[model samples]
Target: MLTEELLTLAAAAGAAVATAAGTDAWEGLRTRLGGWLGRGDARGGEGALAELDAGAAELLADGTPTRAELERYGAAWRDRVITTLERLDGPEREEAAAELHRLVEREPAAREVRGGDQHVQGGIRVHAEQGSLAAALINGGVSFSPPPPPVRPEG
Candidate 1:
């Protein structure tokens, strides 16, 4: 098992990767991250790309990922990251961590708007909170909450 800090880092990386899907940054991210996760192995990189694509496809089909679904993906990738890191020596692990950090830092902020914010891929559109978008595609699922109270001008 990874230490608490490492697990957190893995989860963050997973979330960042998830957020980058279906965006302009996705292709570059997909290739670079796949290469990293694959440890320079072409087959491994391809596998990673497939996984990323499948997740994006799922989101497109469902329209939004449910909270549970996003968590599932996050957990899945987190475990993968942890496993990959575990196999590395100290220096390699540090380098991987640095790379992951860079990836996370580069992710765009999430948008809460309704229209243009949707991520379109292969002509399929999906709308959800930015970072949380990965899990927005819960089939037949809908979430509702009261809108925030309007702000009043200072008296």
Candidate 2:
């Protein structure tokens, strides 16, 4: 099994390759990540993307990633492509890389806010937090707690 760092790197690489080599290349990642994802399976039939869907809930639910982090991930992949081209010979290099760059420019979803975030990671946290807060007052979820003392923690 690949380490967490390797898996994240592979995911980022696959995303880049999906951008450069197109989505077809991402299938390899699906297969490679599939087995690892399956290790935790109780059902033994769920797909990698499904596991990712579950994982995204945990990571992104905290908050949306800062725009800068997303930008850095994209930039690093583009740089990898650039570095690859720099090592190649001549016209063929430019032509091939140009094609990949064209594909890159034609990204399937130019600005999708992917993964979980408060806005994107809907369902549980947003609903639960709001519901719990409301219930705490009305349903007395915190009924056992004493009234605030005059010398308060905040003060």
Candidate 3:
């Protein structure tokens, strides 16, 4: 039976792996995750890499993955991680858990926006000969104003 801490780590790792799939950070996360799980074993690391690739590919191919599919992937990775954790000795388990914590803490890729309120109807053309082309500079430090007309005293 897994302890509370180990169970928490397993859950987090599962979510992180699933969230990372198909993201820009996918490659880096996959490499580090594989290496971590590999535990300095070349063949193990290679196998992990292969698994990550296949999972990522499957997730991406779905276009819009269902929640069930996501859960399935997450559960699988969690089980794999739990198995790995169980194999290690006490100190090794601590080290591996620490590494997994770091991996989870790393930032994930930015999500892309699907839709926006922005609309465009016609082309916009602006020609600037010299200093500034903007008609108005709002909410900025720089301010632009026309020069004051030449002061004239009474003749």
TM-score of each: 0.61, 0.31, 0.66
> Alpha carbon lDDT of residue 149, candidate 1?
100
* Model 1 lDDT, residue 68, Cα: 77
Tens-digit lDDT string for candidate 3 (74-125): 7898899999999987888889988887776673311110112223344334
Worst 10 residues of 1 by lDDT: 109-118
Residue-level lDDT for 38 in candidate 3:
96
Q: Which candidate is the best by lDDT?
A: 3
For TM-score, candidate 1 versus 3, the one ahead is 3
Q: Give a tens-digit lDDT track for model 2, residues 51-148.
A: 44343343345565455544554454434434444455667554544444344333333212222221323222223564464322233222244556
Candidate 1, residues 1-155, lDDT tens digits: the string is 55665666677767755666567877877777788788878899889889878877776577667767766776677678888989987788888877766665565532211112344333343656856644344455345667689999999
Candidate scoring better on lDDT of 2 and 3: 3
Give the Cα lDDT of each candidate: 0.68, 0.40, 0.75
What TM-score does prediction 2 earn? 0.31
Model 1, C-alpha of 35: deviation from truth (Å): 1.4
Each candidate: RMSD: 13.6, 18.3, 17.7
For model 3, name the residue pairs that clash: none
